[model samples]
Target: MSEIIGFAGMSHSPFATLLPPARDGEPGGRFLADSTKVGAAVTELRPDAVVVIGPDHFHANFYDQMPPFVLGVEEATGFGDFGSTAGPVPVASGLGWAIRDGLAESGFDVSLSYALTVDHGVVQSYEMATGGAGIPLVPLVLNTAAPPLPSLARCVALGEALGQAIRHAPDPGRVLVVASGGLSHWLPSNDPRDPSVVGERRSSLIHGRQDARAFAAVREPRVRAMAGNPDAPVNADWDRWFLRQLYTRDLGPIVELGHDKLEEEAGSGGHEIRTWLVGHAAAGLPLVWDSYEPVPEWITGMAIGATFPVPA
Candidate 1:
């Protein structure tokens, strides 16, 4: 059986790639330094494979056919949005297939993608956590952006199932789980199904897969615009509260908060916490170290956290 050696949850933003390297004493800079520390810890574990649980920002999966969860079974590629690297990720295909089967047995009818193309959401966390090391990984994409989304409880359940799958897999190697995205911030996303979301924006959300880069390009300006807005909100209090729940391994408040309430307090982008919940529950380990900073310049409350490694 494979062992979950470690777990990490970190906030990701394109600003980490788009803007100049953050200077010391700046929120962004502090986040970068803390992320490096978390990455180094992950590398120290030297796991056989890493499982990245993150959300897709309409780069690959779209409303054309968005599943609640997707497992990259064969190939995974990065789109390189926000100046990040674009290329194939070293996917652990055998273990990915095992996880898919395991998920199915556990009542999770997750979709499988042989050619999954992810954006900064997954890649940024992967890069930050492993420092771009050539660690084979399985990318698990969740639908956090789109509306009519899965419940937070369901995300927790999925994580529990995922952890079980990883533990019971035939491979007896070490596997690390990384969750990417969110503390508190907002994005200019609207439900494509909504009547107000007309014109090209709506079209892009529904059928953007044909030209993923073009859609990304179109959306880039909105994200960049947020960086310039001085009034962009980053709820530090909410971020700290969420981190407290994770540190204490108490998810009842998070689940009770629900999607609507989270959006109300943490902003729309806070939906990405679903990824963190999944990763936390999947690891089933204690969080040993963490750091947080409300980086309004990046339009996201930046945070980094990791779990204690299991005994080898």
Candidate 2:
């Protein structure tokens, strides 16, 4: 029996399109483009099915009792600078059902929306995963910034519950449980400007083997007295806890796909994209992290948030 394959996290940064020289004899477009590396990655994992959990940038209002569950989505032709196959994506609705039941079992009243459009984060991720072809999906919508968004621990529970759901699924091999986004760099998410900024940074500051150390350095935190600093925001600390969930037994050493700072939007900082991957342990090397490093002075005040998961 083939075991389930896990894809722990990634924000679907668009730069993936360029890494592999496009393979010849492959279709090119939103759903057919083959001159990309995303293809090889999946072929390597070779899963029988995929289950993706990505947070929606435009999450539906959670406060509304009448919230419409988003069961589907369609995007423009050139979302991530390419298009392959879009979907009549078939979600293993069971997973969402499991999440709702699991949450209720844990005592949280909430609504589920499957009626969603994949913003670039999700769109890019799926395309990247399938090597430009659309994969069958069970889309799990996470409430990223909503008032009643699942707590970090609750989200982790969601993962644990989801693992159980997939094991019970009729067909769940190569079962990819993808939690997209995050791992440092600050930017306000809204209408972002210039995807090129992230692309260039990936090539110049982070991607090459030579800059690997610099990349980890930026992700580490420095301990300091609060009065000595202040620019650090609450979200980074919060993200530390959330991103930790991506490291699972079914998931391992995360690959930092890319990271960058978008330009300011209306004088506010731009949204940041930090793409990464944590795959099945049996299939990959052990995981390494940047959290234990000394925090940079620029973010020392917020660095105190390094303690996300309470020692159990």
Kindly report the root-mean-square deviation of model 1 from the true structure over all alpha carbons: 2.2
Error of 2 at 21 (Å): 13
Instruction: Score residue 160 of candidate 1 by CA lDDT.
Output: 93
Indicate the worst ten consecutive residues by lDDT in candidate 1. 303-312
Model 2 / residue 7 / CA error / Å = 2.2
Candidate maximizing TM-score: 1
Taken over the whole model, the C-alpha lDDT of each candidate is: 0.87, 0.36
What does the lDDT read for residue 126 in candidate 2?
Answer: 57
Which clashing pairs does model 1 show? none
Can you write out model 2's per-residue Cα lDDT over 103-172, one digit (the tens) per residue?
A: 4565544444555445444555555555545555555445443233333334444445445545554433
Alpha-carbon RMSD, each predicted model: 2.2, 15.1
The candidate 2 region of ten consecutive residues with least summed lDDT is: 300-309
Candidate 1 residue-wise lDDT, 121-239, digit = tens? 99999988898897999999999886888999999999999999999999788999999989899876669867888999999999998998899888988877777454679999999
